[model samples]
Target: MSTLDQSRYLATPIPGPRSQELIDRKAAAVSRGIGNTMPVYAARAFGGIVEDVDGNRLIDLGSGIAVTTIGNSSPRVVDAVRRQAAEFTHTCFMITPYEGYVAVAEHLNRLTPGTGEKRSALFNSGSEAVENAIKIARSYTGKSAVVSFDHAYHGRTNLTMALTAKSMPYKHGFGPFAPEIYRAPLSYPFRDGEFGKEIATDGALAAKRALTVIDKQVGADNLAAVLIEPIQGEGGFIVPADGFLPALQGWCRDNNVVFIADEVQTGFARTGAMFACEHEGIEPDLIVTAKGIADGLPLSAVTGRAEIMDAPHVSGLGGTYGGNPIACAAALATIETIEADGLVERAREIETLMKDRLGRLQAEDDRIGDVRGRGAMIAMEFVKPGTLEPDAELTRALCAGCHAAGVIVLSCGTFGNVVRFLPPLTISDDLLVEGLDVLELVLKDL
Candidate 1:
């Protein structure tokens, strides 16, 4: 028997009664800083569907912002979480290390794409992981400068906020950011009107331009790390043209700079391989990960070559709740599920499905300007017909229409004009097709 459920709701309208009550209370009680992505209040979720308090069932395409790649409430993950909680939950790894934490680290070191003497460190969120990676890189190289790119969304912490390039809400009013952090151009082939070209030539030119900026501003000798998201998450799921990662890796190596891949959104088999960098056969000096590592648990990690990581002093790295036992256990189980169930291959299958369906939509509608991304981390860009200008208005309308039609999709990009898809790898084909159908209907209106 299949372990799945697909019962649609009988309710007339979403956020019918109970959800509205919670929304009213929440708005009054909670800080507005905590943004709401969807109107419906989640009561429960399983497989690929979320049930709201109002008894409305909707297909979840965002997967809690790409954190639940293996699906919510998987038997292995739930049992592991329950068992660990029952035994013991809090024992700071710093005070007394545990087996689960070490095991998870071992797994990360072995799995992350790189052939070197590897070591790993754990943290609470993507932001924490990124910050710690910077610390390690600086300590190792004795350098002061870090470089990022335009439209990148690193995190909300002060340091990451400075590293991040977006403004308003993320960076606005939070400045006089950390010194020694800089920004460069991203290889947005589509926006540059260079799509359908050889990925090597297009991507190499972009990387060369960034190298020029680094040499002129920071001087390669002053740089500690060049941090990049192999596949940018908040920046429109922007997959750099092919050859971009390899070219950047070469530049970093030549300049004696540590290359850091922020794999927080693209790791754990969310892409076809275990890591997005694998697609290019490139190895980063440091790899930062989170999100799908522990099936919703608050866990993140920094794995890389041991020399750089160990350069920090004896007590240079650690946190009180860095590797909570429950999260460690969940991570162990999540990795097991990914291996045993062949979810990496499953992610590739999702890519094929999305391309076939979204490609058809683009063929029919001029607003569907671009369909891009790899594996299950997919996105589409909306543009005015026969023009390169972004149509953020159309993107918002499409997202709103999808929400009303019982599909939850997310809009991203510096201009807020790209719809990114991050459905769970285990999402059933029937439901996935239904969600895509709903998205197509919305595009029809546009």
Candidate 2:
């Protein structure tokens, strides 16, 4: 048997004794608006496992919403962060530009999907990166209309919310959104209904539909850019058809529309490629990336053509906390770690392993409506057997079961029926497979 740690508290259930004490304190002291998935409190995490305050060791499949792709407490990242902190933590880049920040930007310009005269500006979050991308697009194109796809999750900021599609939680009670943002259909093959077979054609159709809307409603001349998640993240990890992205890129090129690939969740080898757009042979005009950028530091960036990135007036794009030195150091170290450890190849290995396990589960159970994703960023959509209808209840149950079995899993999707797995790329194969086995057992119960 694999010697992976499967320690479970025989004393009490998870949120056991010590964690429950923390939860009680949290409910009284902290904001109730923020939700807890498993009601477990973490003490520390490394590689794939998060040891909660209760001393329950749970395999981390979520990777803290895919932020810690390299791993939790990676030696290089930790040391870099510590060293940077020792030197200085907060010398705002705008006030005094630092070498680490400049290095990170340069690295991003080189690493992001595009080649040829690229530039990058770092920000604090995915939303900020996205906001800057739009700013650049609008400033460069001299347009007001920005188009995004349905079921897309850009971020929580006002402009991003306007760009986002899901109405319930994202848009609910936050109306009077930013103007000139338009919504288009994403290629959700599993839920395409009538349009499933023509996904390629549908991509063109979605573009044409948006173009028609722009022509009639917003006007092509008034449109700034069309931003899309290369692999739609919180929106169900929807991978578009083979020709879809390329066709959309063609449309954008022909129409003079800036094609923005939101690599916030798919960048940094979380997907098989360094960037998801690379999978489709696409070189987007602007690429927004965050999430996995700096291991766990709050860093993000927009890298694009030099002319466009420089279009905005000097001092137009920046924030007080944007590209803090510590985060920059973490980012530099993360990049070095990715290359030095060959995490990109590791991501591919993870994809194969996950697909093999999840595919087998899918084959055995029809509740798994769809088992789809690229690389380690895999997800399975649960649905009522023989139907496309979402089974969020079963998804919840599966996640709970996995947690009980000492594995942490996360549920996503507009309908909350998807269980996405984003284990640290540095996770041991033994631990990863154990987590998969636990998940399989959970699914069987479901």
Candidate 3:
């Protein structure tokens, strides 16, 4: 058992003297483009607690943007990394090759949502994984056009910048991006004007409308793949209505378009399932995974059908540091910990607790327009009371309040009006409830 205490303890104010000093130093030393949600500097983090340089322990609800689903500094991951480092840190898988890399690929091939023959190639980040998946799809199909949805956030790279939907921070003035990428409408049940309250019953129709746009605008014969997040992360944690994913997957199959599920923030037991696509029984041709894959170590993967994955030639898919031995070891141990500790079930339990508490909050506050998501990946969208108008100002205020009270929260959405919660699976019930209590108090004040 771990000895780390999971609780919030504010010694001084948030960003106390030590952290404030570091923040000042950071302004002078670091780039201005890098943004931070909280001003505190972490001394250490374990399980659900982040101990700042000033000794203030804050409840971590963001999990470093869903990168530590198993937990920050999880023992298994630390142990594996240490053992691998003691043996050898980096041989560069391309040059020397390592068993850990093969083992991780084998595990991903078996674990990702398919029973058929599958293969995986590791990468350094989600953007790299997504880029490689697109390359493989285009190579296999001999097509140039690719499709992504509105409100999607793939990454910051040139190709992924073209794929991402939001523009302000990720893509503004960063164009001209890669060509042949088309945008489609996602099945957003809350804001779909056509169906309104009946969106749940109109999921199939919503999907057909989006597909119709693609069919007419891009044409089926010219498209290489259709990429999407199983449950969008930075795009407000939007979970499509039932039948939406299935309809899209069926259309992709009919049109011979590779259906790619970007599970960067929704994979590895974070969504009460191994992968979010599994929840809807939609098997994607290529699945891009990262964030939670290696317990915070930089690791990503593109796992998919053997036929498509094998389309690339020798030296066609790999990077110098793509599958670092330490990261591979960490991933293997992290996957072991998730399975042995039953974190998938823990995620479902978190969903129940969060929904019960946040649902009551929604009932009491009309400004909370919608409370949606799955497993530990839940979010609340703020709107003008009784109206669909997004309230970004209210969202900012609520997040600031939480930060001041020694709780870590994060905001997302194209409009920046959604508060997302992605707590580690190892968090205790009491600590989770305490975090929720802070949020409830903040909401009441607003």
Candidate 4:
């Protein structure tokens, strides 16, 4: 197997004969509940392109749902994983510890927001990290009620499903969720009434309104933690108005409620900063991270204040495969790559290019209700022209068009009318522009 070409090439149809064969096999072997955005099967991926089994190169704008920030098959991550695998794959940190796992924890402790004494616990996925964070919060605060915002997506587990707000695929039939999880209003600037007109001016007020709701509904004295995405990921890439985070954090501090920043998708320099909370100068009490943490490895972590993290009893936080040596090695290398290669700065460059291209598209298309996000995590919400009514049908058509034309884009939003762009930070300017060109053409056709 050779590295994929870092440019678009369609040797066959979108889901060519080979991919169709694989898709057929998958349908027979895999569960119908597993959703696939694109029918093509990937052979290999590098930089910003995914080469399908049929030899079609598609520009990857989704970046495996923001997991491949450094890029697919990153040399540093690949080398680290190979070397660690040869040495040792797993020791199950709980039973027998490894240097790599400790090193990764140390790195996360120092890197995540807040200069205070911090500690970390690793997990295999974002949902696990979030669940652990909640557990720690409850243990420390001695409270059971937790608050999550509307349109927020923590994970798919039973507890996180209760934290999540979207209904259809995530929480349609999975009813009778965990108890004591409450929902609060989020400061969605694009959709919020009146505040959308002057976000900067009304942000504080919006924050106060949300806080008021939480105070009234979920009493401040009864809350363990207020979990939120610094910049919401699955909820259409919604960026809260300025002053909103600060106000919420302040309220949490005053009321002794832990503020947990779910940086799973927005961490690891995806938002031009190492963590999204850094952009607002807010230091969360606890931070949940995953996605880009180990480039492409299965890793997640909850890093927080020392006292709170230490509140859990001995053997309370360890998992069999939580901090596997291989994944830890990849995380160490991924962090080093981010710092040495200056991928944080690269994310800002990608943002500039995206804003320039998508801004022009938004100007041309009235259906583009809003264009928002930071760094490489950008999105455009679709709606009826000159109206706020969501146009999910158009959003789906545009994504399908991009897929057929050898570009991979993802859709989100509570109303299912958001098209998000999360290209790898390592994507070349030419490749990024080319992908955006395909998106522009698709929008125009729609």
Task: Estimate TM-scores for all models.
Answer: 0.97, 0.95, 0.98, 0.98
Question: What lDDT score belongs to each candidate, Candidate 1 first?
Answer: 0.89, 0.86, 0.94, 0.92
lDDT of 1 by residue, 266-383 (tens): 9999988999999999999999999999999999999999998899999899999998999999999999999999999999999999999999888988877889899999999988
Clashing pairs in model 4, backbone N/Cα/C closer than 3 A: none
lDDT of 3 by residue, 355-420 (tens): 999999999899999999999999999999978899999999999999999999999998899999
> Where in model 4 is the C-alpha error above 4 Å?
1-3, 194-201
A best-first ranking of the candidates according to their lDDT comes to 3, 4, 1, 2
Instruction: Write down the lDDT that model 1 would get.
Output: 0.89
Tell me model 2's lDDT, rounded to 2 decimals. Answer: 0.86
**Model 4, span 286-317: residue lDDT tens:** 99999999988999999999999999999888
Model 1, C-alpha of 365: deviation from truth (Å) = 1.1
**Deviation (Å) of 274 in candidate 1:** 0.8
Looking at candidate 1, the ten consecutive residues that score lowest on lDDT are: 1-10
Selected candidate, larger TM-score, 1 vs 4: 4
> Model 2, residue 229: what's the lDDT?
94
Point out the higher-scoring one by lDDT: 2 or 3: 3
- Model 1 residue pairs with clashes: none
Write one digit per residue (lDDT tens) for candidate 2, span 1-446: 12324443323587698888888999899997678888888877877777777667788889999999998877899899989999998978889788998899889888887668999999999998999999999999988899888789999899999988888777899888999898766667788755556643466655554456556766667788989998988888888766667877887788778999999999999997888898878999999999899999899999999998999999998999999999999999999999999999999999999998889988989988888999999999998999988999998988888887778888889999999999889888888898888888777765
